[model samples]
Structures are given as structure tokens and as C-alpha cells.
Target: MVNQAKAHIAIPMGDPAGIGPEITVKSLAKAEIYDVCKPVVVGHTEVMKKALAVTHTNLEINEISEPEEGKYEHGTIDMINLDNLNIDHLEWGVVQAQCGRAAFQYIKKSVELALEGKVAAIATTPINKESLKAGEVPYIGHTEMLEDLTNSRDPLTMFEVRNLRIFFLTRHVSLKDAISQMTKERVFEYIGRCEEALKRLGVENPLIAVAGLNPHSGENGLFGREEVDEIKPGIEMAVEKGYRAVGPVPADSVFYQALQGKYDAVLSLYHDQGHIAAKMTDFERTISITNGLPFLRTSVDHGTAFDIAGKNIASSVSMEECIKLAAKYAPNFRS
Candidate 1:
């Protein structure tokens, strides 16, 4: 019997020409997944069957039209089959327009279900950017697609690994542009938002550490003035607003300090600043959460490995971690 108390996590199989299907099947094959939540694959049945054959898994597929119809049990994986892909013509380990379109459709369906309250949360696989472009999809990646679909503006992103949390102030922009975007106003706004995101994740009165942009946090304006001019003022503003925010902490040491339990979360000034720290700590265990959304969403921090598709060699650790994190935080997630 499925545990009614467990949250239902919708898994959208990413690019069919990639390792999304393989890892989704491999991750769901674990018994531990059933112990925590009821997972339903929002993807094509044929693609999932091929993945099962490649991975040599004995799991059976239970196709359903809706989440409520799912058996939600172990040994039998429930899938909301979109039937969008023609598996005979689909080739793995390459970019295909058809695969890209199918991936987007899967995500759309999962988002629809989440909005309708049919599912508790979503744990997404990776989609390819080239395929998406080839397919003429309007969005470049999942974040953009989700934002447009949900009508959300500037969604917050947080990376979680081994109890360490890092929130990005800026992402998917050039380093020069990223630095240019750093200002006292921007930092102050993001700090408040990051604190609220932590509270949603069940952290009470979160202590947020702001990471410095330059070497030694500008050495007091010796290297750069971003720390002294913008970051510190932002932290002060956040603190004055009754938020427990601190530091334009030196980038070199802030991540390490946060990992050692010095703070509940670290506000990374740019993309790679926090990404490198979290990934280096544990690459496979790093799960990315999209905050400030209408529903909870988690994803594998890695990309779609087109080279290793259908090789049965892709590690499912990241997918497992994504699902586990969604289940762990779903209880406290609002809407």
C-alpha cells in the first residue's frame, strides 16, 4: 500500500536523447524512494521502457492518466504517459528537435499537475539547451520555462548539499555583467528574499551570510570597493529590517564557514561563486531548488549527458538526492 502520508513527487523525464530517462528509472528502482514519497514519472512510457531495458531493471511500468490513479507503490513505477515520443525513430546520445519538444511537454504537464494540487512537488531531470533551441522552444532552460509558465519574476535559486545552503544573487549572466549587477539595493533585496526562502524550507530565524565579490572582500577597498561600498551596506539594511543577515564575508572563507554550520545560508554574489563551493563539496549530492515559486521544485544539479545516454552508465545519485530533498522540504513548502 502507498503511504498516504508521503508526498507525491512528480518526476519529469528530461531530454529523451539524454540520460534523463535512464537516471529516472534507476533512481526509482531504489526501495528507499518508496519509503519517503510516491513518485510518478510525467513522461513517455516507451522511453521509460527502453531505459529499463538498458539498465536491466526488473521494475514494471504502471501507466496512468492522472496522479490520483497511480498505485504509488514500490516494484511498480507509476508513469503519467504523455505518449509524445516515437521511440523507434528516437536516437540516443544526440540532439533531436523531437526529443526537445517532448521534454518541454513533460515539464508542462508536471507544472500543470502541481498547480492543480494533484502533486505535492516536482523533482526534475535535466534538459538540453541545444535541443530546446533546435525544437524552437521559447525558453532556454528549466528556470526560464518555469518562470514564464508560472508567471514568476526573478525566481530565487538555492543549492543544498550536506546541510550547507548557498543562494545566488545573480545567475546565467556574464561575469562582467554579474559584477555590474551587484549593488547595495540588489544585495539588500536578495538577502531579504533568501531569508524568506530559508524560512519556507523550515529554517527559523535564518542567519544569512553575504559572500564578498573580490579578493579578501576588497581588502578594505584595496582590490575593489564592492564589499565596502555595496555588500556591507546591503547587509546592514537587511539587519535593520529585522532580518538576521551578516557579512560581506570574504568569498574565500564564507562558503567554508557556512559548510561548518556557521550560518543557515550563504548569499552568493554570482553564479560560480556558490556553485563551485557546493559542487566541490559533493557533486552528485548537490540538489538545486527553485525558490519563490508557487510550488516546490527541485532538480538534479547536473546537465543532460548526451554522450552517455543509453549506455546505462549515468549515475542516479543526483536524481535520488533531488527527490529526497523535495520530499524532505515538501511538508513546510507553502502552496
Candidate 2:
């Protein structure tokens, strides 16, 4: 059980070239954010300063050498300056190996903090896959990188929202590649993770709906047999295991039902299948949770928004929501 003391959250600066710094600054400008919990940014202090100047947000930026020295004051942003990057060569709207490497450092430090119990949870901004690849991280995104760093092999993706928590059994793959990657064991493992995640989110008895891979849930195998051979069997096994699970439901309707509160969450077969639905339904207000991690991690559902990187026009709604969710779940992180 977590101590009821105020939890400190570490927000990793995503890609430096992206809008991560700007959004982080904007998110900290709100005074109420510090009221719930203490937030310490784990990234380059110069990059954050640049973001603050770009956004023209009048908030104060406090650079602390460690998370414990952070001042939990309103209108002030305290950061654990990794000092890993030189902001001189970063170019907006382009991917750079240096930025990627620096982003990875920020994440590594945040994970270290959680493991050491210096912070209660980790909240991250979105990082670019191309930047990460350029940096030679050897993984697609944060989830995979975290999995590798922690030596976890389970199939895990970002879970968004509570009422309609969504999971991607296959992410960052072509439609064809995704279909090839779908296996019964992988599907079952995702279901198991979803079940455990929901219970952690405070649902005593959660109901999960698994979406079909093909049109009309394979239209009874006319469209595809994955539903019968893979998805349905996984659902059945989950149900037999005493979890309230259902589906191989049509992908189109499963999300509709989820939005209407018919199910606690939906396990989607691929990336766009779940992400597109959730983001389309609620773009600004959605929350992204990285499940199967050793500690609770949540982040803004949107990306770095390079197009609007320095304009100060980026919205902080998602970041604010992420902060709130981190605080709400901070009590659940076992320390």
C-alpha cells in the first residue's frame, strides 16, 4: 500500500524537437496542478526554458538537482535536470539522434526514480519513433523501450480512459503484418493484462469486450477465421478463468457499446482499430496509461504536435488530465 503522503510525479520530456516541452510548461502553469501532487520534470533544463520562452508562459521554472529538492509551489515548475542534451543542434520538425538519445535518458531516469521510490508515478509526453530509432534505442515506442529496460516480454500497449479502456494487441504494424502477428496466446495474454489493469483501476468486477479483427467480426468466418480461431478462444478462456469477459464482437459495434458504458474496456486487434476509435470519439479529454509496468505511468493521449511545436498554440488539456490521473492513481502504486 502506498503511503498517503503527497506523491511526486516525474514527467519525462518527450522529443525535444516536438511540442513536449511547450505542453509541459503550459501544463505546469496551472496552479491547481500542484495542489494535488508534486510534479518534477525529468529532462533538459535548457530545453524546458526554450519551451517556456516559445510559449511565452509567464510561469517560473525551478531547476532542482534532484526530485526531493523540488519546491511544490503553485505557478512554479520544478524539474530534475538530466542535462543530457545540448539544445544548440536541435531542429524543429525533424528527427535527430541526439534528441532521441536524450529522450531515452529522461525516461531511464524517471524509471530509476520510481524503482527507488523517489516518486510515486511517472507521467510522460509522447516521443517520436523515428527519433528513437535514430538514437539506436532499438524499439518502436516507449512501451517497447520500457519493456526492454525492465526485461518484460509481455505484449503491452497504452491503455486510454477508464470507462472505455482500449488495448492494442498489435501496434505499429501494417494491417497485413498485424494479422500475421495475431496469435491465440498473444490474444489471451492481452486479455489477462486488461483484466488485471481494470481491477487496478478500481473496478472490482470489470467487463471486457474483445473486438473482432475483420469486418463484421469475420462475418462468421466469411471475412476471416481469426475471430473463431483466435479471439473467441481467448475470450472463452478468460471467461472460464472467472473474469467477466465477452466478445469477438464486431469491431464497429464494440466501441459503440464501450462508449455507451456497456463494457469496462475493449481489447482491439490492432493499432488503428482501437486508437482511431478512441481518439476520434474523444480526442482532447482522453488519457493514456501504460499498463504492465512496475509503476503507474500515464500521459497525454496526443503526440508532440511538431506542426504547432513553438507556437504556444498547443493545448494543455490532455497534459492536465494526465496529471490528474497520475495523482488519482498515485495512491495505488505499491511502494
Candidate 3:
């Protein structure tokens, strides 16, 4: 259990043009979120104000200069305004460099807070990749950015949800590129990370399922030998290390069994194989937790819905679920 007085959680308001600010306002308007932990948003207050007006949410913005000044009160949105970007120049539904810079600042501030022990955990909203690049912060996604910022050499893994965890052996790469990166050593690292993540999630004995790269798990090497050569050997190494792992399982059937609690987590050979299954199974409720970070980090599984920005139609379900999961896992790192 965490000491209520010292435990605070920081949420970065993602791309100002996106629905991040809007959903953040909605999440704070609820009374239940504050009951478990103190949630302080690390972004500009003006953007949140605009979001409230756009979404028609009845949330009062508490502009805090520091973490200690936060109200931590239910039905009130507290912010540690970084004051980096002016939202006036930001246009909803369009990518811009300024918005990207703002998003990056928010994440940076949250990371500092976590490292300083001002916050117990960090939960982020979706940031647009194009905007990030437009701002000159060249990162493909949050996982890569966080890894660079934290200087973590350990294998960075993304876990989709608690019961049905999945990791992308390769992210933001073409199918052809993914094939090249899927070496035996990298696959072994993924398996190791999966094993450690399951233990962190309180799984006493995790049954890891590995997915095949090609169709039908390579059809016994008829299609591709990745399953037979790289993936199978990785799983064998993990099992040798005392993990109850077995696979190179066909991608199609693996996720189905995982959802039914047959496996603790599935390590997909590539991005879509795991993501399609996770999102299809439960998109709204899915939470993405980044493993191998110094502190607990969780984010919304979905991306910035540029199409629905300022329309007051974006769903806050995923954001709220992400917050809950962050709070749920924060206590695990109290030491």
C-alpha cells in the first residue's frame, strides 16, 4: 500500500489538437478517480479549459504551480502547467509542430515528476506521431521516446492488458523490416520480458504463448522458418530458465485461448498480429503498460482520434480505464 500523502500520479495531456485534453477533463470530473490517488495533469491549463468548453464538461480547473499545491479534490481538474505551448495557435484535427512540442513537454514533465518521487506513476494520453515529428521530436511512439529519455537498456515491452498481455517483437516497421529484426536474440529478450512482466502483474506461474511470424506458424517451415528457427528456439531458452513457456503457436488460435485464460500472455512476432487481437478482443478496456521502465507507466491503447477532435464525440472509456490501471499498479512499486 502507498502512503497517501506521498503518492501522486501525473497525467500528460497529449496533443492539444486531439481529444486528450477533453477526455482528461472528463476523467477528472468524476469523484471516484480521486478516491484512490491524487491525479495532477502536467500540461497547460488553457488547453484544458478549451477542452472543457468544447466537451461541455462541468470541471473546474485548478492551476497548480507545483505538485504540492495540487488540490487532489474530486470533481476538480488540477494542472501543473508547463507553460510551454500556447493553445491559441493549435488547430484541432490538424497536425502541427507546436502541438507536438507541447505533447513532448507534457511527457517530459511527467517523467521528471516520477523520477523525483513527486508522482508514483505516469499515465499518458495518445500523441500523434506526425505532430511529434513536426515538432522536431523524432520518436515513432511513446515506448521509444520513454526508453530514450530514461536511458534504459533493458528490452522495452508493451503489455496490452492484464490477463491477455501481448508484446510486439517489432513496432513501427514494415512487414519486411520486421522480418529482418526478428533474430533469435531479440526473440529471446521478448520472451524474458514477457516472463518478468507476468511476474510483476502478480502471476505466480505464467504460461507464455509465442506466435508464429508467417501463416499457420510457418506451416512447419513450409511458409517461413521463423517459427521453427528463431521463435521456437527463444521459447526453448525461456523454458530452460524455468518459465512455463511453449509456442510458435499459430497466431489465430493463440489469442482466443489467451482470452479464455489459457495463457498468461502472448508474444507476437510483429505488431499487428498482437494488436489486432487485443483491440478486437477489447479495445475500450485495453490498457498499454510499458515494461522495463524505472517507474510504472501506462497509456491508452488507442491513438489520437484526429477525425473526432473538437466534435465532442471521442470516447473517454479508454482514458478512464488507463487511469484505473495506473492506480491499480502504482501500489506495486511502493518500496
Candidate 4:
């Protein structure tokens, strides 16, 4: 049975050449998933049927043109078939331009549904970057694509695992460029944004701790001056503006402190800083949430596993977590 009060979560099938289809089928096969939300996969029905056969899961594929037509039952999987992939020519574990284009179309459709209020939220699978480039897609990854599609400016990314939340100050840039881009002004702007993002996630008063750029937070200018020169001043400015911001805490210990509940969230100085902490804490459950968008979007932190595509061995824990998180936070998301 399905919960009529539950929100509808639109799932975008990732790269067809990878384990996305496998994971999607596996995750939806679990009856517990229907308890929280009505999930509608936005992708090719043929691809999902292939996934069902490979995984040996017995679930009926109920194709529908819109989310409203979904059965939302435990024994059935509802899908909005885009019919973009040719399963005969599709090779698992290989990058194909056609697969890339198909993946983009699925995401585009899910985003459109979310924007139109047709779905409560979107829980996305992994898309291969190489395949996307081969297809000549304009965006690099999901975040960039969502930003462009929604016309959102500087959407904030927050990773949650086991009650610990981490916000990246910088992502997808070289360590050198990341360091160079860390300015007081940027920090100040991000702190306010981070605070707002937390509030949107239902945190009434978020105490955000900013991680340091150097060891021991520059050891008070011993290891480096980035803390004294920029980070600390930025925190001070944010504090003066009535934001509950703290740190230039030592990068080594701040994540642990946040995990221990000392802070509501940690503002990581760069990509790996936050990614390493969250993934190390719990790799499978480290779900990514994109804030500052018109609708809530959650995704599996893992990538499309090309080597194990169609192998029935890929774990769907991350995908399940992504959908659950989207459902958990959808009610609070602002339009």
C-alpha cells in the first residue's frame, strides 16, 4: 500500500551505460521505500526492464505519462518513460554519446516536473561526466545543470551523514585555485548563504563552524596567515552581522567536533576537505543536497560505476538514502 499523504519524488535515471538502472531497480524493489514517498522514475522503461531482469527482481513496471497516474503501490514500480534509449545497441559499462543524451533528458524532465510543482522533489542517480561530454551536453555535472536549468545563482551544496552536515565553500576546482579563491568577502557571503540554507533544511538556528585553511588554524600565524589574514576576519564580520558563525577552527578537528554535535554544520574550505570528512564518516549514506534552488534536489554521493554496470551487484543504499532525504526535507523546502 502507498501513503496518500506522501510526497511524490521524481527520480532521474543516470547514465544508462553505468549501474544507475541496476541501482534504481534494486532500490525501488524494497517495499519500505513506498512508506515515505511515491517514487516515479523518469527515464526509459526499456532500460528499467533490463535492470529488473539483470537484478532478478520481480516488480511490475507500470508506465505512466504523468506522476498523477502512478499506482504508488508496493509491488509495482511507476515510471515516466522517455523512451530515449535503444536497449539493443546499448552496451553496459561503456560510455556512449546516446547514453549521455538520454541521461540528460531524464534529468531535464525531472527538473521540469519539479519546477512545475508536479513532483515534490527530485532524487537523482549518478551520471557519467565522460558520457555527458561525449554527448556534448553543456553542463559539467548535476549541480551545474540544475543551476542553469533553474536559473539559480550560486546554489549551495550541503552533505549530510549521520546527523553531521557539511557545506563546501568551494568545489570542482584545483587545490591551488581553491586556496586562491578563499577571500574574506567570499567567506562572508557564503556564511550567510550557508545559514540560510540550513534554515531551509528546517534548522531554526544553525551554528556554522568554518574550517581553517591551514594546520591549527594557521597556528595563530605560525603555519600560515590565511586564518588571521582572511578566515578569522570573515567569521568576525559574519558574527557582527548577527550570524551564528564560528571558527577558523583547525581543519583536522572541526569535522570531528561537528560530528560530535558541537556545531550544526561545518563550512569546509574546499571540496576534498568536506568530501573526505562526509565520505569517510559514512560513504554509502553521504547524501548530497543542493540548496538555493526552486525545488529540493538530493543525489547519491557515489558516481556511476561503469565497471559494474548491469551487474546486479551494485548496492542501492545510497540511492535509497537520497530518496529518503528528499522526502524528509521536501515539506520544508521553500518554493
lDDT of 4 by residue, 1-335 (tens): 12247889999999988999899898998888999999999999889888999999999999999998999998799999999877899999999999999999999999999888889899999999999999999888999999999999988999999979999989988999998888999899999999999988899889999999887888899998888888889899999999999999888999999999999999999999999999999999999999989999999999898988888889999999999999899888635
In model 4, how large is the Cα lDDT of residue 149? 95
Task: Please give the CA lDDT of all the candidate structures.
Answer: 0.91, 0.82, 0.82, 0.92
Model 3: colliding residue pairs: none
**Candidate 3 lDDT:** 0.82
TM-scores, one per candidate? 0.98, 0.92, 0.93, 0.98
Which portions of model 4 show Cα errors greater than 4 Å?
Answer: 1-4
Which ranges in model 3 have alpha carbons more than 4 Å from their true place? Answer: 5-7
Candidate 3 lDDT by residue in tens digits, 1-335: 23674368889999988989888887887787887778989988888888999988887788987777878888788888887776568788899999898899899888888877778899999999999999999787787778888887654556565467787788778989998888878877778777787687677778888887778888889998887887888778878877788888888899888878998888887778888888888888788888788788989887889999888898888888888888887877666
lDDT of 1 by residue, 68-121 (tens): 788877888999998987788899988999989999999999999888877878
Clashes of 3: 0
* TM-score attained by model 3: 0.93
Question: Would you list the clashing residue pairs of candidate 2?
Answer: none
TM-score of 4: 0.98
